[model samples]
Target: MALTNSKPKIAIVYASATGHTERLTEMIVDASVSQGLQPEIFPVKEFDLKELLRYDIVVVGTYTWMNGEIPRQLHSLFEAIEQQSGDLVTGVFGTGDRCFATYCGAVDLFRDMLHAKTQLAATLKVEQMPSAEDRLRCDAFMNSVWRKYSQHVENLVAAKP
Candidate 1:
């Protein structure tokens, strides 16, 4: 559903093959709540491109595959967000094995395009599932997003008169 509210909407959309990315998504969701921001979590397959207009912030998570290709399920969302989310703040995160040459390469792929398209608040790369040490990074990512959203709102208000 399209959102129309004073509360800034955030969506954590992701693709997870082995559940590692999902674990990261949960951390992001919890972080958003702790920031006093309600967020919607969607699998990349279930996300609607048009729903992007409803959000002020968008976070994407993925697991890197062999080399660094974006998962097939996320390719379309990857392209669509750049086209639609220019005014929105965005963050990208992923989980991957550091043993690989391109650790969390999928995060890099998304990060490049998001920087070109959205406000690209923060990008995080976590090796596999998040551990206690990663909690600080997750909180920082969420804080960055909240700061961008707040600044955007302030700018809007200032511009109005």
Candidate 2:
């Protein structure tokens, strides 16, 4: 379990319709940069599912659709993730309106799947456009995910000869 001393690869994959999720992506990227970690951003449609395993960390930003259903665009990525061997550290976040019965159900759906498929670090959901309050939450999410990865690497090193 000894992770490489080099920096871990990080990818932020997301889907946005009304731009709320995209905004969240910006916040996450900013937070990661503030923490000195560079994360590559990918739109769900453009990201190659085949390239998923190349990253040590994956963060998904999604939008709910059709009453809590995960966006159709996300289905392939979801399945690909679930099929992985669970070494990836993942975080899930999304945006939705409160009027929906499921709120940000897309995030919840991704959360559950990632939890089972990878080392899940954090899950975040924001209403419509993000507010100032959500920025703090974004920082917390970045901290949590980084902390999870750091602790795991530390454990590996401690257990090393």
Candidate 3:
């Protein structure tokens, strides 16, 4: 299907202390918009679980802390997401210093939790200090997601015939 005509609803929610993750979320939102999808951005602190359930795709972004863990504020949001166990399609992303032994630690946590509970559409690990390459990577990842998701929806529609 043509992305502009897909009318897919996408949400990019993130927890960021130094703004890197938040910036990445914005990039994803921009890409979504360019693809003709309805996109929204929410900070973990300001996110509403009920609103999240309405989206066809939920992209969760987080930053890793000193101990390779998600920020405390986002922990509760993650728990809430896990508890719902709805059929919402989900994706994960994270920004962290590549110097760390466990790069993109938060992405790992998000992936593990979602795999153990809900269906995951994709996972993107973006670098903390983004360069031109990083931006291209993020755009590519978003494009792949849009393509895969549109295909999934198309298959569902075709099966109903």
Whole-structure CA lDDT of model 2: 0.89
Flag the better candidate by lDDT, 1 or 2. Answer: 2
The digit string of per-residue lDDT tens for model 2 on 37-67 reads 9899999999999899888889999989988
User: Tens-digit lDDT track for model 1 on 1-161?
Assistant: 12233678788999999898899889888888988998999998889988778777889999998898789999888877878746788999999998999888899999999889888899999987789788788999999988877776676666665
Highest TM-score, which number? 2
Clashing residue pairs found in predicted model 1? none
The lDDT values for all models are 0.85, 0.89, 0.75
**Candidate 3 structure quality by residue, lDDT tens digits, 1-161:** 22233576777888888888878887777767776777778887787876756677778888888767887888877887787644455788888887888888878998888877655767888777555566666777777677667666666576665
User: Which of the two candidates, 1 or 2, achieves a greater TM-score against the reference?
Assistant: 2
Tell me each candidate's TM-score.
0.91, 0.93, 0.83
- Angstrom error at residue 122, model 3: 2.0
Poorest stretch of ten by lDDT in candidate 2 = 1-10
User: lDDT of model 1 at residue 112?
Assistant: 91
State in Å the error of residue 109, model 2.
0.9
Could you tell me the lDDT of residue 95 within candidate 2? Answer: 91
